[model samples]
Target: RATKSLSLTATSPINIALVKYWGKVHEQLIIPANSSLSITIDQADLCSKTKVELIPTAEGAEPQLRLVLNGKEDKITSRIRSIIELMRERTQGVRAHDDQGHTLTLDASELRTHSLIITSENNFATASGLASSSSGLSCLAFVLSQLYGVSESFPDEYTKFARLGSGSACRSLYGGFVQWHRGFQAIQELTEDSAKVSDQSLARAVELSQESMEWWYNNLSILICVVNPGDAQTYQKDVPSTDGMKITLETSELMKLRLEADLAQKHIDQLTGYLEERDFPKFAELTMKESNQLHAVCLDTYPPIFYMNETSRQIIKTATKLNGQGNIVAYSIDAGFHVFLFTLKENQVKVHEAMSVLPGIDQIIITRIGREGVKLI
Candidate 1:
């Protein structure tokens, strides 16, 4: 008998959503109310490097997985193991080989020991509140999927699975203003017979075509106000982000307004049209207002959750007031404290210079439209 191993490496960027994905409807599935948009960043300087190996081992042993942060051997939990187990089930008969070049079977239950070494590093310092966890989790799920032999043919499902680990992660799966469509729950309200018929019709009517959706290509820049810089920490101390959102949905009336905002619909339509027309000033105006509206709801939360600070607020004001010419720049933030400044490449240097003078801030991380969600190495 021989042993074989598969080593795969992938990198993903931390994204800042223009329209935030703060709340969730389904905790386990991580379904959001509305579609959120984002642009991926460069992976060279900041990313997660993961290596998954499968080995044939003796019986009656506890299956193991390991995570290494920097050079230290950190611990792994059952939740992490469950993620691998789920992948194993979905990828049965998919095998890796050891350095000896012999095939090694990957059975989650049969394995007594395993090594899933994950090493993540960031260009900026840790605790900066830059949504780095979103990128890291997305990359982790992505690399594991490849090493475990899950087919890449279904990009949507693959992205949805990645979202289970981090909501913003689904956006990281696509490049250049990717939208996560949280389709209306009209299906949930259907009668059983009607639901079956509707499902069948949807399956048939879904056309896989690209000709109609190709107008979105253009040059857009996603600039990060990278504050505080070390590695991003997992939100394990609080309720799972998904569960926190569920609790919010139940108690927060603002969440209700967010779900049913008529003006918001109008704003989205007008902004989308403005985007298409390249109306820089109007687009930037709408983007700033919409982001403030989203944050208002966060303020309405009981006990309140503040995702911004004096510096973030001042940056918004400075950018809005200082616009004297060309392409207008827009700003948006997510659950974390960092700001995502968007503009055309021509206006980037100006925006960069303007933001450089703001107080209590660090450097600006510049990223353009990314290539794709996950790439294999």
Candidate 2:
């Protein structure tokens, strides 16, 4: 008998959602309430690197599985465990895309019979909002699937398993402009039983080819200013983001008008056109309007959670002043204190310089929208 070991590693980049994913539809399945659009950031700036290994285990001994994050061993979350189990069951070869579909046979594959070890690490700084988690899980799924040859066999299921860990994680599986379709019922129709799943879903993802990568990569820039360089876990607030969204969904009048798939599609249509034509003014307009709309929804929340602080407000005012003078610079803030300045590459220098001196801004992170996604190594 011969001892055997197999190993592989992969890296994936973080992303910023232009069209935000706010609420949840199926909490148990991690489905989003609405569709979302995003672009990945450069892996060099921020990413998650994961390595998975399978080694022959002693006969009759129970196989072991372990995961390490940032060099520290930690217990695996149930979501990740679900992904592992799904991968194990897939060894018998895939059937149709139906969730109720079954494997052909219960074959003890190489992966199932061996002890496994998975290690992942994020390249982040103090100002990081821990945005790398999505990329981390995405990288883990990518590498393991690559080893199992899932990208060619069952690409949709590969992405679907990533979403099991985090809703946004599915989007990081692709590059360029990406969309995550909402609702599970609608998603089933998007995939063909025997064909490739080209479109995206809450359980899967699709990457859209906007302008060529070269065009956007050279023309667009995002200047991220960390107004509050604090860990999201350590930061305290009146209402947690998830709780705040739930309150808004139930009580806010604005939520009644805005939380619909039709609205998302309308915005997606116009934004997609603007992106292809490089219409900075229209692009900036949508960016600013959608951002403010999100904040308005926050304000309309029952208890009114304030993710944007005084400094955040000041940056908005400053950007308004710049845009007043015929500049296309726009800003967006997530449910956090950091502000993102979206501007043309030509004006990036001026936009970055003007925002750097704002009071309470601790650090400036210069980054362009990345043109690629996860890669197996």
Candidate 3:
């Protein structure tokens, strides 16, 4: 049966992982090898705005998906197709009822047949090795969920559903300080009398950030230096992260040692504590160290992957100088050459001074963390 037309709009902010998610346990499911934490930057700075509509199609009409990113037609269609199919499968067993308990559709088959029109635009450059995919997919998932009334029926499926589009996209769905907890860690701590809940069925409050200290996240400033400024459309890694991880897991003995030491767990513990206590020194130290080790793991890969260049190393040096001058800035470089400098609001002047004088920096973007999460517009 044909359905009435419906549309929804949404915006989701980009997130930068502090404890990076470098490997995957299940690529199909997008399950990470370790839990990762991130800060939701200001929505006004970098975000993706999306509009999803469900229009009644002709009896034999096929689903139509139109994607325009940053005002240009791109090739992200296949990813969106996978997401829709996955969501449809999840909705298979679901039965939607009206106010009077009347079934809305004949069955799941009828619902899956419904077509959707998706239009998305990003505030920043997409496919440029930036976090555009994370934000765009997040916004898409949120809008799609609303169109399907998934938000009202099954609240827990939102992030998990968004994850199908992109792994880091799940973290973008939440605001403030968010962590995609690796479910396996739950096994080490639960009591005997506790329910037989797997990592997926754990119990915890949704908002991990404490309200009394929400202001802490708001005041933190992040300065992004796009050293590589690669095209997001083809913003691929010099060494594909997935391929690099496979080689690292199989060949790098350091990775095995790090796993044995529970390196990510240790980093998370210290970083979380430093964040809570507002210890800039400890926070900065661990951030830099983890960033270094992450790259070291990449280098440890069989072929020795390299994402950063000469200018990236220079940026790190400049950040250290800022720290020495009492500015207290911490820098983290991801798989790309982009550098994320974390500092407090008070040290923004020093940050400006240091970044402005630095040569070869294409752009220095100043923004904050712990911003409001995704929402309908």
Candidate 4:
């Protein structure tokens, strides 16, 4: 038999959620408690590049899988294993033409006869709450789909696969403005089938008018402020997001209000309108408010998850002070110390300067909003 080896590479940009996804309704399916919205960062500035290869294994040998992240050998987490198993199940009998124009067919049985190797690297910090998993897992899903010739059975089908690896990862599968729908209510009211629920939990790009797109590209800029340039792994949260969410749901009264109000969906709707109208002040206000609410919910959680440090608080104060004079800047922080500031290109320098002078800020990266999502190199 001819040596059948296949490989593919893909890159995905990090997506910073404006309307955050803090909790989960379904853990195994990675369903969110609330819908979320985000802007994809440009891949050139921050992204994860993932490459996968399948090589035939000896007839009597059990196929093995290996993963290397950022030049370090890493154990295949259960989440990643689930994504691979899903890809294998979905890609059975799928066929496509490779880059060399050779027709390739994927066989479920034969897939088990091959060893898989995945190498992924991120240009930015990981585990420090910069949404590195968003780019990392999305890139993994994209490369796997491309390699196996997996076709989307529904709209954003691949996004469902990405969501299996990380909830926010689904948003990274698209570019420009994207939204991850919270299908928990729909799933509960409908059916309990896992596959159906996964299908309903989807992320899709928000349609922006050509003018809005142009304005966003031309006028908007993001400043990523790194609070500490130390090893990102050291900055990993004491409380994992999943655990934090579970505690919040059980203990935080504010969390109850947040869910009852459907705050995330509301913010997404309002932000979408503000973006369309090119109303920076309204957009900025909503963005900052949502960020505050997310942290507040964290504080309300029993044992209170504290993802922000004093330096993180200082950045928020500085941004707020600057915004008092003019709403030229808005700050959003995820479950990490890094602060993402959104401002117009005209005020980029001013915003960067203010952030740079703040103590404990080690680095500030300037990049524009990304217009594309995961793509083959």
- Candidate achieving the largest TM-score: 4
Clash list (residue pairs), candidate 4: none
Q: Report the number of clashing residue pairs per model.
A: 15, 0, 5, 0
lDDT of 1 at 111: 36
Per-candidate Cα lDDT values, in order, are: 0.60, 0.70, 0.72, 0.84
Off by over 4 Å in 3: 1-3, 76-78, 92-113, 152-155, 186-212, 228-235, 325-327
User: Which lDDT tens digits does candidate 3 get at residues 286-355?
Assistant: 9888888888988887878788777788888888876775548888877788889988888888787888
- Please, what are the lDDT tens digits per residue for candidate 1 over residues 170-268? 666655455555544432432323322222211001111233223223456668886532233432213344555655666678777777663444565
- Residue pairs with backbone atoms closer than 3 Å in model 2 (clashes): none
Ranking by TM-score: 4, 3, 2, 1
Native-to-model Cα distance after best TM-score fit, residue 49 in candidate 1, in Å? 3.2
124-184: candidate 2 lDDT, tens digit per residue: 6523554655798888877877655456645566667677777778778766677777644
Angstrom error at residue 190, model 3: 18
Worst 10 residues of 2 by lDDT: 97-106
Report the backbone clash tally of model 4: 0
lDDT of 4 at 326: 72
State, as a TM-score between 0 and 1, how close model 2 is to the true structure.
0.82
Write down the worst ten-residue block by lDDT for model 1.
Answer: 199-208
Residue 151's lDDT within candidate 4 is 44
Model 3's alpha-carbon lDDT is 0.72
